[model samples]
Target chain A: MMEATNAELYRLVLTDAPYVIGAYAILWIAFVVYLSMVLARMMRLEKEVDLLESAVSKRSGE
Target chain B: MKQLRTAIVLVAIGGLLTTAAFLMAFFTAEVQQFGTVTLEQEVDTVFPVAPDQFQPPAGEGIAYVRPWFSQKIFYFHVPVAEASFLVLIISAVFAIRFLTSKRAEFDTKSRIAMETALVFVVLTMITGVLWTRASWGVWWEWEPRLTTYFIMMLMMIAYFVLRNSIEEEERRATYAAVFAVVAAINAPISFMITRVIPSNHPVVFQPGMASSNLLPFIIGQIGMLMIGYGIYTARMTEERLRERVEIAKEALEG
Candidate 1:
């Protein structure tokens, strides 16, 4: 009984390797980018709060 | 410091177990055989039964059915997939607690758990795609498991999207918590429906597994759970620190 060869099976599977790899790579990159954006926004908000505090202190002093 | 120590310990143990599982999968588990074949020099040769001389003995199969790399992927894939679902459930539990108690800590825990689940879900999707591509001919298929996972991936992404769209902290937490519970509930149903409605995709789970295969799988699962718990704890600690910082800033302003 002749069955499907290993090479034939390998060929069938190998074609989709790139797609799988590409999908994962893209997801990881997106996650990192989103994290960076969130960090940046938090920093900006902190700066704004500091500016507001200094302004209020100066007004009260005046 | 105590929490940090716990996190480090859990991570270390998890890493060690994962490594051990990988080694066991390769060296200990029996190589799975597919079917009997008759060797022929001609590529197109097809026969019901090629002569005895052409056959390699019944016991002496090919060196390996699947490649070493493909088989290795299985260890990581199944573990991460299981961990992702477990974390999702944890997140939903926290979400329910938050809704009932209206406690900030529960909300924080839920959010962190969801984030951890997201990381594992992405890992699951990647490994799943690789497995499918290797085992089946196609890169993407609308099989039950794949479809359900794809839906889960989207739902998780949507949870984050919903979070970003909301500005108020408490409101954001509440809405996210609600959504998390709904998504979590949907996950199992998705799995069940998919399995019930059969498709072209092959069902790999058999009635039982050999001891060698079972051991590695269990080890991998335990390691994955520990790693997931560690990540959740670490993220929660970071969030607590951020909250403290925010409170201090508010105090200074007030």
Candidate 2:
């Protein structure tokens, strides 16, 4: 009875493992994707700001 | 500049804490007993055929408490749900402030917070769906909490639609702020629906949770809040950079 009950625990863990792993995987992936997006946007804005600064400096020089 | 640094630090700390909570949930926390169910016939589950808790009669099984339903998902689900609710409130509060102050910064803050709220809400829904599948053996159900939370998600989506439809800046801000406030009302209602109405959804925040469960839950909640704030602040930093670019464009034109 004891050994079988323990096996039941193992079976339960194995059975539910997919849903548990899936939930956590989705969360971590979402964070990674979200952070990547923010970083990409920031980089684009930096490039634009650099271009604008040079243009402004060039204009003032002229 | 300092805020961005703080945000990074918070994200790092939050990530570590949540990871620890996840580990503890599986390793240290005792498997919670959800009580028993009386079955007219045998059910196919990973549970033992006849544990001590089982009541015996042929084809009539009194099942033992099954940890298979919510034990694992509860850690992630509850934290994300609470964080989403908190972030929604933050967005609504900023929206109200924007309305009163007529400040563009407040509007930016509110908008960024709304984006964060939406992200958390999506995560909550995803985790919740997984839980329902494991517990109820279905991908979707029209239970009270699920229905109300679905409405909340739709309202949030409509908020962005309303924002995108407007071209003028002030008008867009005004409309979005109002919409944000309206959409945020769903968070509290969705949260309380399980308690107020009958729900198959387990109500987890009552006084009787074991220390084993409560400890990890608290850690997970704190970590999620920090992560939410970190994300919001980081997004705000990006918005500030965009504003700088806009200012430079105006300077060139002037």
Candidate 3:
């Protein structure tokens, strides 16, 4: 009976492995998503600044 | 440009260090044993074995303990949690400066810091939940430590909502700054409450971590702080560019 119980516990541990993997997956995904959002915002802002600078120079020349 | 360059370097270094820490955790650190597993071994006695003796002496071994997978999450969760609180304190410092100086620049700094804090807080919550679920078999609990953190998260979100609701720029900054200060106060209270109240959360430092465990933890901490600072600087650069564009437009109009 004791041998069977120990074997069962070990099997449970193996079954629980996926939860551990899931936790790490969520962590990496959250960081990557945030990084991408920041990068996208930066690109949008850069385009806006370029357009505004060109507009300012064009108007000043006139 | 120089600030952006520095931020990039910090992020790259942080990434490398964190990867190294993760490797060490899996390959080098000892798996902490929490419960005992009984083992039967031969008993050597001075006298001859008696017929009444049914079994041999019991021996203890660390290898018999079940694998502690949840312990691995500690390396990441703790560093993120500490970084979140530190950033909150920094945001409050900028908030106080803004209140006294009433400079838009100070306000912008405070707001950016708070934004960084928000990101960390969210990450902390997610990781905390994962750890709790893995260890305790529950996804959510209303324990003091967790409840305090939930309140802190709400207050942070409310700070941004308050800023958005107000139309006047100065009034918005003032309200947000005050809220940030309140959030700062809440942060330490939340952290200390865990110590005051007994909780299931393992105290990693109370009993000194093994040197093998300490190395990865330290590496993770430094890496996490670098990433936090990198995120903050990147946002700051974007905000500054937006401000410059607004100024150029105003000059054109003038």
- In terms of TM-score, the best-performing candidate is 2
Q: Backbone clashes per model, in order?
A: 2, 0, 0
* Residue pairs in candidate 1 whose N, alpha carbon or C atoms collide under 3 angstroms: A1-B49, A1-B50
Ranking by DockQ: 2, 3, 1
Identify the runs in model 1 with alpha carbons over 4 angstroms from their true place.
A1-62, B34-38, B41-69, B200-206
Indicate the fraction of true inter-chain contacts that candidate 3 also forms: 0.39
> Worst lDDT window (10 residues) for model 1 chain B?
B39-48
Candidate 2 lDDT score relative to the true structure: 0.84
DockQ of prediction 2: 0.42
Per-model TM against the reference: 0.73, 0.89, 0.87
Better of 1 and 2 by TM-score: 2
**Deviating ranges (above 4 Å) for candidate 3:** A1-10, B36-64
lDDT comparison, 2 vs 3, better candidate = 2
lDDT of every predicted structure (CA atoms) = 0.70, 0.84, 0.79
Model 2 superposed RMSD (Cα): 3.9
How high is the lDDT of residue A20 in model 2? 84
User: What tens-digit string does per-residue lDDT give for candidate 1 at B105-188?
Assistant: 999899889998998898778777776766564679987778878888899999999999999989999999999998898667
Candidate 2 chain B: worst 10 consecutive residues by lDDT?
B34-43
